[model samples]
Target: MTIKVLVADDHAAVRAGIVLILDGAADLEVVGEAADGEQAVAMARELRPDVVVMDIRMPRLDGISATRELAGVTDVLILTTFDIDEYVFGALRAGAAGFLLKNTDADGLVGAVRLVARGDGMISPGVTRKLISAFAAQPAREPSTRDLSVLTAREQEVLACIARGLSNAEIAGELDMAEATTKTHVSRVLGKLGLKSRVQAAIFYSESG
Candidate 1:
């Protein structure tokens, strides 16, 4: 299936550039564009695209708020000019699939969109050290910590793999489970733990140790 995408950025040139690259992909389509956060939210509801490339800062509404609202409605891959640690931290907190720097090369941008469309998150390796350490510093007493006992043993095993940065396909292979079943398990982990993204779950797992 061709993944339909909504590009939301305040700058006309930026949106056009994204459309140019995305429209070139044979299996991807840009069905809509929004110039601000409010329009991004509205467009997602109206067009129901599979993915939304959101900007962290925009007029009318910031990307975080829009991301919060659009979380389950559509996957959000933050497309922002800021590559600061705080931006990545907040975007992930808002349940964004990942963060993409505006100056990213064409191949990197296209890969990010495709990865998010596949229900996977993308984080740049440049920020990996900061993110891993920041999340590691989170207190164990923090509210998002969940009780792993609630999950079946296999589910707990799958959740741990997710925390360890394994993709659903990798988890399936590691667990000798079907990919479909692996997705179901991953979703159940998120729902049961009140977690938003794998990043959050990873934080909990690392902090719990």
Candidate 2:
């Protein structure tokens, strides 16, 4: 099936470039383009694209707030120039499925959009480690540490692998299980933790550790 996408960036060139890249992909379609966050949200609601490629510093609503509003209704992939963007944590917490740098290669960008469109989370490897470490440094509550007790031993192991930025295939290889089984464990972990995506699972594991 063709994955419909909405590209939102303040720069016309950036939007054009991304649309061009996506248009080249046989399975991806650019359904709409927005110059700012508000228009992105409005177009998203109207177009209901499978994914939204968003920039954080857009005018009016901002991508973080827009992601919060669109959370659960559609997936969001944050494509921006900032690797350690100040708004990165907020966007993830607001329900973005992935965070990517604008400098990412064409294949990487296309792959990330496809991954997020299917409800998987993707974060730049360096940014993932940095984000986890930064969030882990914050003061966490006592009860938050105990939340891991709810997970089974294998589930805890899966969570740790996710916190380390291991994909399902990697986690499966590490645990000597099939990739599909690893995915099941991941889904269970998220459901048990009341989390939305692997990004949240990673954050929770980091803070709880």
Candidate 3:
């Protein structure tokens, strides 16, 4: 399947450049572009791209807020110039599937888009320390651990994998289960927990752990 992507950045040149690189790939297409955070959200809802290449800084709104607003609607891969941008953690909390440096090479950029499109997550190694420190400094919230006992063992396992950022196929592989069975388990877990997406599941585990 061709992976549709939405490129959002304030700089016209940057957005055009991303499109040039992505459009060259046989398996990828730039379905849309947005010049700011608000436009990003609107275009995302309108086009429903598989992935969004988002910037950290933009006028009218910021990437973190846009990421929060669009979480679960589409995968967000943050493209930022700063290695240690403060907004990276917020984007993660908002369910961004990947984080990348603006200076990342063309191949890395394409790989990130494709990975996230396939329901995987990634971050550049250079910025891993900053992300770790940011996650560590924040006081973890106390999630409602009591009510989760109602879930069956299989459901619990699915939830754990979701929290770890695994796609349905990945979970199936890890559990020696079929892909269809994995979907049923994930749906069951979501229904039981009253959660909308894996991002929430991940946050719950992060706090509970």
TM-score of 3: 0.82
Q: With candidate 1 superimposed using the best TM-score fit, by how many Å does residue 84's alpha carbon deviate from the native?
A: 2.4
Instruction: Give residue 17's error in model 2 in angstroms.
Output: 0.9
Task: Decide which is better by TM-score, 1 or 3.
Answer: 1
56: Cα error in model 2, Å: 1.0
lDDT of 3 by residue, 64-181 (tens): 8999899658889999997656676677767787889888999999998987786667788876777667668998676666757879988888888988778888999999999879
lDDT of 2: 0.87
Report lDDT (CA) for all predictions.
0.84, 0.87, 0.84
TM-score of each: 0.92, 0.78, 0.82
Which ranges of candidate 1 are over 4 A from the true structure? 136-146
Clash pairs (backbone) in predicted model 1: none
Greater-TM-score candidate between 1 and 2: 1
Task: Estimate the overall C-alpha local distance difference test score of candidate 3.
Answer: 0.84
**What does each candidate score in C-alpha RMSD?**
2.1, 3.2, 2.9
State the lDDT of candidate 2 residue by residue for 1-209, as single tens digits.
Answer: 99999999999998999999998999999999999999999999999999999999899988888888887677899998887546777888888889998889999999999888765788888787887588667787654667788999999999999988788888999999998898899889988998867889887786675
lDDT comparison, 1 vs 2, better candidate: 2
The candidate that achieves the highest lDDT relative to the unseen native structure:
2
Ranking of all candidate structures by their lDDT, best first: 2, 1, 3
